[model samples]
Target: MTLSTDNALVVPHPLGLDYHISLQTPYCILCRYAVRPGEIIAAVFGHWGSPSYLAYTLGFSFPTVAQFEYGATVYEKSRSTSYPWLFCRRSDCYNCATLHDTSIYHIDCFHIISKNTASKRPSLRDIWTIASWTESLPKTRYQAPPDITLGAVADETLIDDHESILARVCSIPQELRDIIAQRCPESPAWRLVSALSRWRIFQPLLDPDIEIKGFSFDDIKSWCRRDGMVAGSGGSGKIRIQLDDLGVSRLDYVNDSPALPTAASRSQNAWFVVEEVSEMQEARIETKGPFMRIHKLPSFHLWDTPVPPDPALTRWNREITGNLRILRIRSIALKDITGLTVFCQHGAVRWIYPHHEETFPGPYSYPCDNSPSMAQLVPSAIESSSVIAIFFPLAKGEKISSVWVRRCEPYDDSIPDTLAVITTRGRFQLFGKYLCPTRPEVHFQQLSGNNTATHLLFQDVDFPFQRVSYFAAVSASVNNTGISPLAPSQLAQSRGFSWSSSFCYVSIVGLENVELIWLFRRQVPEGTPERDRLCLGMMLLYEDGTLAAAGNCRQGPDIDVQVIMLPGSIHYKISHKAGGVAVECATLDGGRDAILGDEEGWQSIDMHSRSEMRFWFDDSRTIWITSPST
Candidate 1:
């Protein structure tokens, strides 16, 4: 057969002796020319250099060009090869198949004639030849090599090897090392390396083999005796004490808070056993049945020494171990001590003793030490205050069972009279009067379940030096086991006590043998309002005095009273009957007036008629009652 070289690769026919055959062509080689009746087609060879060399003996008659195109279309649409195409030696073939893996042998033009295109179809051997050729093709597509420049190669060379990189980093100024470390990627390996390096630098200062002596709570007697002090008694029998790395003795007790009534009563039974005391610290003892009272001792000086004066005492200017349960200060007069830190199990408490040149030494006394002083620890103030006591609850459902007491020179009257109690749930303030002039005491007890009560006893030394005491009760209700439900009268007695400027009002009503108490407070605006404002809060008081149903008040027909006061409506109303009080708002002479009844007896009030009435007890005290005309 004769062929054109424009779009074909002509090769010697492997089976034919005198005739030539084209192995690769754009059109079908078998159907490119019509076969004569006396001539025979030659065998075509493919994949010249590939492992898979397929040969097809072409002896069949050629079909119509249209029929050939139809078969090519069918083959293109139906054929799926597992192997990529073999790379051709031709330059054009390489470029055209740069990113493709299809066969470049032009088999579609040769053997892919559709069966329905002609009456005579190719034999089975011819079909097998095409299938085998497609199967052996390569599967991976070719990708072009990336362009590389001499500058890029030079830049890469500048990146030092691992050893060189480490050496360079180590050689930099010490200050810059931290800057580099901060910019480094946050990988575990990098972090470990950094930590190890830091540890290496500080190795000389650390005592790797430092020995700490372990001791049980019972053994504390021995340690206290070493410092010539008596041991206290009545701690948890299961507790153990250990001397920590910082040369401070620590008592390790169970982190769990003491159980309710059982633990509370058990604590009272325990007391420190003191046989004798030093002259620097005094101990007052009174034995009355199982109870003993001790007078607070005055302050003493603390010095920096290898061993503490008392092993039971906290370290000076160092953080106490976090696991300490009970911290008993032998000297309760904490007026001049500084840098004394105590870490409670639930929180931390630090003392800032008042700064005085005569009371404390000058900075030159401790030249090498850089620890902060009491004046520096707190915000700049003329005088400092010592945190005398701290109380906190230990259990999950427990109310704040803690109190913090501070003693100052009583110069700043702006200092709040209340102490903020922080618990796991939140924080609240407890306001009370001083119980003692020298020592203020606070006691917390769980009445029932999670319900707690606090008793504060302190002398009011502000003016006439009178004795004062306060009792506060709160309900946590985490567990069920305590006080009975609260009555309306009980709730009235508990409400309306405010140390802050916020005004509180309580109204009680009885219906169907059930008493209900509603508490109301005026929302004070930050700035003076052009008109008066009124807001109401309703609450249901249970028999145990716990408040519930607290929500905003809505005006409706079912409501007993809708309290709304306008501007210039400030007035007081006294009930004729003792202990009978109410808040009423009415329009008198086309002006609104709100009246709040006082807690004292109101026998002097004349309420016979619903008219505008005013009572002047003195120049400073006045009472007014106004009834709107209906």
Candidate 2:
């Protein structure tokens, strides 16, 4: 029989009985019997009367019908309690009643309905049945085994042009790849791998190559020395090696034989040699037969005359291989190192190195004729002195060659306090001293060849006539005739051509309340134009003894004295105060004005003991200084 939303299905017993059974509506069943909506129909069995006949037609036994009644009663009671229940109906077996919102049935039939829905009545069952079904199902799908038949397949054709080759190499085991990477980092494959390896973030991926076994600090030093590289010990015992030219071959030897000589040689030699043996064992051989043994002898005996040394190995070799000359001295403790100098006379350079523990008995005389060659002056000027300077005469027609130095003595001396030399080509060679103790720090500045004249000024300053001496070196170059010591004042005033000057001023500002004033006058050549021809500057002394100089003073007489260029002359006035010092600059043509220190302006400088100051000016017309009393 078909059932409608508002109709109940009635069926007569098939045993020729007159009695009929009718399912009640859900609402009436719940109200009259006080049963849950889900278990309402199950309660109708109480009105069935003679359940044997109804049960026989439905294929259920008498005891099963009683069990259904008992289960329905328990489920309805459970709805009143806090526990949840599942309900099913024969007509809508797929739709099961849920605890929340009875109108919304549970669509997952496996979770709510029994396996044999036909045998059991649509009534509430045990709440544990839902959980039992869930446990019976598998957690995940079954996985198939990998195909071992698909061996190492070639994927080169599948890789796009944009794909990185290093990424493919990384997929291989790192243990096998690391050895190849470390041993030959210059290989094409390694270069590509290293380029991509830089971006790896994990520690395991970074520098995967193992450390080389036999590479040591001594090996590194030997390689550097052979290749003319720089190797030295740094702070905290760290070693730093720098290769100026990587094209030079590194020294690699095995058993007194050169290994990996060059890229070309390495390719031909197969780079490395390997030996394989199935077994290694000690063996001894004994022979009883007499045999004649002959040994090859040298062509000449020890008593024979020895061959002469090669001229190329001698100190006076004259081959003009290159124009660069280098002189290096290893280690020596020369007290008067400042007195050393290399003078270039005619077309040769001369330098002196005294023997160990030997002192000059008297002052050595230099060549009187400045243009004399080494052959003419060596015998007359330096014959008596044991501290004779080594002379290197250039080729007869060659210009003065450039001289370079690798290493020398006075390792802690930064500036070479030696005499300057003027080459025959009219170029100046400034001496440079390095301060590096573990390594060489050579400093060489090529002087302009166009400079016609150069001036050397040695000034000694002493405050309060103290015994402590302060020496300052100032070099000035001009495009005019060179000046002698006696005619410095006259040369300063001479003006025949337009000229430029460069000078450095160094001074130690004493602790006393002395007003240090510096006066600079620009000496314009007589015929030169006067528009903006003069510039002035002042060096401010810091409490730490370092100097800071300001140039082109244009602003005001500010608190921190501002420097300005006046047409005639400019001077710096420094006064020592209690907490700080005051500096002022003014033109010679006007009355002096005092500038007060302020926050936005130049703050007062703290005065300290023996504060030092230095100023360097370049491309100036002329500069001079004046000292003042405290």
TM-score of each: 0.18, 0.17
- Can you tell me which runs of candidate 1 are displaced by over 4 Å? 1-398, 406-408, 411-419, 433-630
Which residue runs does candidate 2 get wrong by more than 4 Å? 1-574, 578-582, 588-590, 593-630
Please state the error at residue 428 of candidate 2 in Å: 12
How much lDDT does each candidate structure score?
0.25, 0.22
Which residue pairs of candidate 2 clash?
514-630, 553-563, 553-564
Query: Which digits, one per residue and each the tens of the lDDT, describe model 1 over residues 43-79?
Result: 4434312323233332332223323321211111111
Global lDDT of model 2: 0.22
Per-residue lDDT of model 2, residues 1-630, tens digit only: 221222122232333222211111111110111111222222121111111112111111111222332121112212122322222223321111212111111111111123223222122111112111111111100011111111122123322232445336545565656655544333333322221221121112112252212222332332322433223311122121111111112222222221111111211101111111111011111111110000111111010001211112111111112111111111111222211222222112233321211221122221111122222222112222212122122212323222222122343122223223333433222222112222234222222222221211111110001111111111223322222322112112211211112122221123223233332223334664322224344433223322222222112222122233331222222222211112344433442333222313232222322232222222221132233221
**TM-score for candidate 2, residues paired by index:** 0.17
Model 1 TM? 0.18
lDDT of 1: 0.25
